[model samples]
Target: GDDVRVAAFGPNYANEKFTPRCTAVSMGSSNNVQRELCRAKVLLVPTKAEGGPLVAAYAWALGVPVMMHNTGIAASCQECYARLTGDAAADAATALSIVRGADTDPRWQRP
Candidate 1:
């Protein structure tokens, strides 16, 4: 969708194909990564190839809703907002709504 912007935080390899809408940002230190992750409304994990439990775990710890295709790691993320609706647009909307409602959730005390 026109509203969705994807930023890939890593080096761009010659063999990789990145769309125009997706910006390739350089990978940073742990603190920088944490700060960047905290700013996102949703953390889309996409596939097992992208990462494993550690990434999902971090997103959950920070209260960011994670959207990923089925994987053992994805299943392990316990946030109520982490369900994949299977429709990309719908999932994105749900993710944004989850972030908007985060302040109201008693379970999520801001870090």
Candidate 2:
């Protein structure tokens, strides 16, 4: 199997037990949130709720693809990404499958 590491930064991660493959860190201050997010190869947004287009737009602007639930907002972004069903488990599974072969979408390409 390919090596995979999971790291989460947030209060939700505190006191959570994870497999050896996963790690959690504090979310820290808001100032550095973007910087921290950029470190990731892909941004995972697992919420069923929609936070408007900017949420996914910002990630794409940072050159990070987002795997998020299909809440209309993500699809509206007009970017290529794996759109997830509302089911948490299913979404996560689909995201993993997509990311394995994911690449920067051509829409994000610059001349």
Query: Model 1, range 15-105, lDDT digits (tens) per residue?
Result: 3466544555555455476877787767776554444647767877887666776676665545433666678779877767766776786
The candidate that achieves the highest TM-score relative to the unseen native structure = 2
Model 2: per-residue Cα lDDT over 17-109, one tens digit each: 654546645555555767765766567776677666465666777766677766657756545556656776786676566555456545433
| Residue pairs in clash, model 1 | none
Which residue ranges in model 2 land beyond 4 Å of their true spot?
Answer: 15-21, 26-31, 78-80, 86-93, 104-111
Give the Cα error of residue 63 in candidate 1, in Å: 2.7
The CA lDDT at 47 in model 2 is: 63
Best by lDDT: 1
